[model samples]
Target chain A: MKSDMSTIVKTVTDFLFGFIIIFGIYIIIHGHLTPGGGFQGGAVVASGFALLFVAFARTFLDKKPQQLYGLFESVGLLIFISLAFLGIYRTFFYNFLANSGGLFGMKITQGINPGYFNTAGVVPLMNMAVGFEVACGLSLIVYLLYRGVIEEGEDGE
Target chain B: MKTAYAVIFMSILVVFLFTAITTLHPMGYPGHTEMDDYFIKNAQIEVGANNVVTSIVFDYRGFDTLGEATVLFTAVISVVALLRGVKKDEE
Candidate 1:
């Protein structure tokens, strides 16, 4: 009976985590259509990971050193800036990938509505870039707090 | 001890009540309004971006996006500096 109960509890927790992750991804992708954006959605997704870490008492994030988070944060920022510059040069805020256009003129639209999925110019790419930065930045902050490297009295705390 | 606890609880209740009452009050001024539907009518032509929010953020508010990126860079730099010196200190 105890084993069965434990299995049920684990199943419920897994379902909840999966649901949160999926919802977060949906929010990130549809940011242009709604009020939510990459920061909010990425934080939500990271919270899902945090929930899993807490429930399982596992060192899920400890496998990677802080340097990896730093690298991701930097790269995400770079991608975001590059996209902005590309926009400036290409008719200001022009999402170079939204239409049936790519570097090699590949049409990834797949005949979907221009306003539908994968249609918003540069918005999806920006969302993804911001999501990567925010997720890594927030996770790294939390990890530092857990490791006692950052004190509660710090400005962010 | 009993008196102190009662005082603390009463204070908490009072604060909560005050907040609830203040929040419930209706503020003055429904304010004037205007009907500007230029963008709604020609969103694609005006912004050239299908998503209105994207047009606003990247085109209308492009400078704001640059500022936000600068802030993120500053944050990342500070974090990297904070995490750098632990090994030297330990030795």
Candidate 2:
């Protein structure tokens, strides 16, 4: 038996889910240029996922999404490490791409100015990697706990 | 009495903490600003990142972020180990 919430919760969750996710991505991608960073953005995204779980509990009865969350977290971590390794030519964690005139190598403006997307070298990449890891990891944590609670409730009944 | 001794100890500790806080350098008047100046001046040119904090975090001090990520990874792994046993029990 799959138990879910009412129509109002379902409607609200559906409406806000996409916005919350987009906000998270926005925070992560603009981390180098803005005030917020990867962790903050990831937490926001995870909270959106949690909101979905809450509003429509039965929707996540399947374990496949939970597993996918874990896998996505691992992939994020791998990408982060690979990016760090790419800077090995000079030293560990060196900014090799800066000023190289390639991807993410825009000449940084000194003072306040409108920032460009294809700048900041590995900062945005690292931000995305960390955002992916944190969002997936936290969502997975919430799902696992929720699953445990549901199981315990079933056992008692 | 024991109550008197406890009060004295607490007062002394509070006084010591207060004194330490009072002795700390005033805001924006630190004992050392050389490193701060260097990062602010050079972060953009050297790191090519507009946000100095990001460059300092992901480039100049990447190891710190790595350590933080490791800690998070460990926490997730521990949670999985604990919760996964429940599913395994049925299998």
Candidate 3:
């Protein structure tokens, strides 16, 4: 019964974390159209995952240090730099993949609304990159804090 | 003990009151300016990015982003190096 209860709690926590991540992704992707952007949304998503680590404790995190937080951080940084350099080649902030011209090479006019998911130049790419970076960086910070690497008081007890 | 507590409470109250009065003024309001309106009108053309905030941060103020990136890179590199050194010491 104790094991079953623990399983149920874990399942609930995972569900909540998944929802938060998805919501955060939505915010990051729609950052061009909306208020919240990469950093804010990314931090929220990272916080959700960080809560999971806290709830599960150190053993869960200790299992795979290389494959987990560090990998995420590196990939996020790479993507961010690549996107920035891509922007530098063309116009400063042109969305490289944005299909302003419709199918069959039709030019979209000023009044025509390109639907959501249209890559608004480098904005979406930058948002995703920053989101990943923030999520990884914040999670790493939280993990270090939990490990007592950043202590509040002196150790002389 | 009672007097000490009362004195602490009074000091806290005075500090809070002073801060509140000093920071907030009765007649302070944001001034609507023509420059703000002008920027709002032509922001899209000037920045060339869909998001105004992204445009402001990445285009208009790109030097700031570059500086921020450099700082983050330096910190991350220093942290990784420190961690590696600690592992070597432990070994």
Candidate 4:
């Protein structure tokens, strides 16, 4: 089976991959204000990585970047778990930072108002952690599967 | 005979599922909404987030998210372990 796609497909993927990643990051960062969240945005970014894997197979296999992605995945999960443990004095996953007037802890205006990015205490941090974990994990998975297929093909011959 | 029994079973199952769906509460009108109302009203002031849903997911129900993250991590680890040496033998 052919590992990489045609010239046109590779060119299009090169053109669009950055935009997809940027859009996913936007969704992740604005998760508290918008409809999207960590998992959804991470999936979007992973799709971009998938496009890259399909378009530039040689680049992926030669670099072995999946190991790096795996490391990032673990780090993101650690950050998430640590954040959860931070409020253990009150309770597990307690909103100790909310309304505390420090680091994403501004009091929100009650009624209709433009939401502040500085508000929403530990939630945004957790969102970013989960987004990072999910994006890296999914991208690693895609790279592994693609590499597996390529290796199997090589072994068959 | 087996085909006739399958057809009958499928039809019965479909009828039951459709009846259950049709009898359920209408859209946007749940039978129990006290929790929803509380979250909607207090999540803003309590969690200090404009998006009530985010507060609920990341704060009120954070344990579940932790569980989800654990599951995802486990899956990725397993995938990596399984596919680690696929090309090594050839090299």
DockQ of predicted model 2: 0.71
- Model 4 chain A weakest lDDT span, ten residues long: A1-10
- Best DockQ among the predictions, by candidate number: 4
Q: After superposition, how far is residue B88 of candidate 4 from its true place, in Å?
A: 6.0
Report the C-alpha lDDT of model 1 over A11-129, residue by residue, as the tens digit.
Answer: 77788998998988887777765667777887888787656544543344345457887798778878888887785656655556554454212233222244445345666678778
Which is the winner by TM-score between candidate 1 and candidate 2?
2
Q: What are the runs in model 2 whose C-alpha is more than 4 Å off? A: B1-8, B27-32, B85-91
The count of residue-pair clashes in candidate 4 stands at 0
Better by DockQ, candidate 4 or 2: 4
Ranking according to lDDT, highest score first: 4, 2, 1, 3
RMSD of 1: 9.6
**Rank order (by DockQ, best first):** 4, 2, 3, 1
- Could you tell me the lDDT of residue B32 within candidate 3? 76
- TM-score-superior candidate, 1 or 4: 4
Q: lDDT per residue, candidate 2, A1-157, as tens digits?
A: 2487788989999999999999999999998887777788999999999998887777686544867888989998888889999888878877777787898888867877677777878888999999999999898888888878877777778
Which 10 consecutive positions of candidate 2 chain B have the poorest summed lDDT?
A: B82-91
* Candidate 2, pairs of clashing residues: none
lDDT for residue A140 in candidate 4, whole number 0-100: 94
Model-by-model DockQ, in order: 0.15, 0.71, 0.16, 0.76
Candidate 1 collision pairs: none
Tens digits of lDDT, candidate 3, B1-91: 9999999999999999999999774676757798666656654544333456765665455556656655665665566555432432566
Per-residue error at B8 for model 1, in Å? 36
Q: Candidate 4: deviation at residue A55, Å?
A: 0.6
Please report how far candidate 4 places residue B34 from its true position, in Å: 1.3
Q: Count the backbone clashes (under 3 Å) in each candidate.
A: 0, 0, 1, 0
The numbered model that scores best in lDDT is 4
